[model samples]
Target: MAVRKIEHVGVMVSNMEASIAFYRDVLGLELQGTIGHPDEAIKLAFMGAPGANETQVELVEGYNGGLPAEGKVHHIAFTVDDLESEIARIEKLGVTFIDPAITTLPNGARYRFFYGPDGEWLELFEPPAK
Candidate 1:
């Protein structure tokens, strides 16, 4: 009953540094910080936009990296202003696209899927302009 919005989405990564780079450099998220879990075997990294606290992305390392048949988390989608340009830019950075082409919804929203450092699916979503 207290849930208002998604606080964060946790993703498992094999290599924490690589995952951090992909999310920070490629996706442009700022590294909030990193901490070692109480268990000591697990390490975690938190990232989000520069000034916005909205939804944060948590990268978990030393967890089960062996994702199911689907993928790490099906895919973590980030909202973008210009889907086309963002796709092109990410593609230029050598990220492979899972979607053959951008998909447009009935409401005019557009989205595309790409891969993350750990073969995890990632998406860029563009909502219809108001």
Candidate 2:
């Protein structure tokens, strides 16, 4: 009950540059910053939509990137303004889609699955408009 909200989701990545580009350029998330772990030799990067008090995406590098067949994190979903436009844009960027088509929820929300640069499952969710 004391938890305010989901702060961030950390994703393990092999190549920081590629992963950063995918999340920032392809996914439209602004790169807040990147730094080398002081205690460890790992690298860390944080990104999120500007001015949006939403869950942040943290990309971890130099850690264990040996992900399982399904990847480390099950999936991370990003709220999008336009599902159709995002799908088309992602396709144009040649990102691999895990789901063949967008799925509509009973409440009218729509979503589609796609893979990130590190094979992490990512989702684009568009809730029904008010």
Candidate 3:
């Protein structure tokens, strides 16, 4: 059976309010809604792109169990037409970023990673060269 596109990417964060503010105010993502799961002891929010596209970032809060550095997802990269401008906009949010966009493969795609709300790693990538 063929697989469809990704529905969402779930991330566990310590703080939900801070995460929501960053994604909504800083990153400019549209806030869909947040639901609290008492059984799971967690709260989640889904953010949509400007075009009403699929939920890109799934903000999960109250996961006090913590995550391991190894065997854990490193970061999430969102594609953009102008990587530099996006980087600048995100920087204004007061988060630190690992920069110096580089090219490794022959295709030479540039990318950079920045900190999201609650210090979650987030990436921004430029479109592949055509």
Candidate 4:
């Protein structure tokens, strides 16, 4: 079966309010809404850009054992049309990215990684046009 685009990236956060603010204020993503899983003792907050498709950043809180040194998940990526322009814009917003230059994949896609508020890795990917 062919897989579709990524629906969302799950992130475990210690503080829902702070995580929500970081995504909403710092990254400028809209707060889609939040839900709680009583059985799991966790709350999920969804955030994404306005008019975006199903893609989202899912911030999770109330999890046990607190935050891990490194989350179980490595990183989450968002697709962009122009990698350079996007990097430049994000850099102006004071986001320091790890890779000084974008790395090209064998499939001709380009990518770079950066850290989120809670030290979670974030990525920007640009695939070759069809």
RMSD of 3: 13.6
Cα deviation of 114, candidate 4, in Å: 26
- Report the lDDT tens digits of candidate 4 across residue range 34-68: 75453357777789998785788878676554546
lDDT of 2 at 21: 94
Span of 10 residues, lowest total lDDT, candidate 1: 1-10
For model 4, where is the 10-residue window of minimal lDDT? Answer: 1-10
Clashes of each: 0, 0, 0, 0
RMSD of each: 13.2, 13.3, 13.6, 12.1
lDDT of 3: 0.64
Tens-digit lDDT string for candidate 3 (1-130): 1112344566667677888888889888888866554436767677878777654777877654368755234457666667677767766877687655533332455667777777766666564579
Which is better, 2 or 3, measured by TM-score? 2
Query: Which numbered prediction scores highest in TM-score against the true structure?
Result: 1
Q: What does candidate 2's lDDT look like per residue over 13-124, in tens digits?
A: 8888999999988899989866554436587787989877578887878767687855645467777778888888878989999978887754466778899998877778
lDDT-based ranking, best first?
2, 1, 4, 3
Q: How far is candidate 2 from the true structure (C-alpha RMSD, Å)?
A: 13.3
TM-score of 1: 0.53
Task: List residue ranges in candidate 3 displaced over 4 A.
Answer: 38-40, 68-130
Query: Any runs in candidate 2 off by more than 4 Å, and if so which?
Result: 74-130
| Residue pairs in candidate 2 whose N, alpha carbon or C atoms collide under 3 angstroms | none
Clashing pairs in 4: none
Q: Between candidates 3 and 4, which one is better according to TM-score?
A: 4
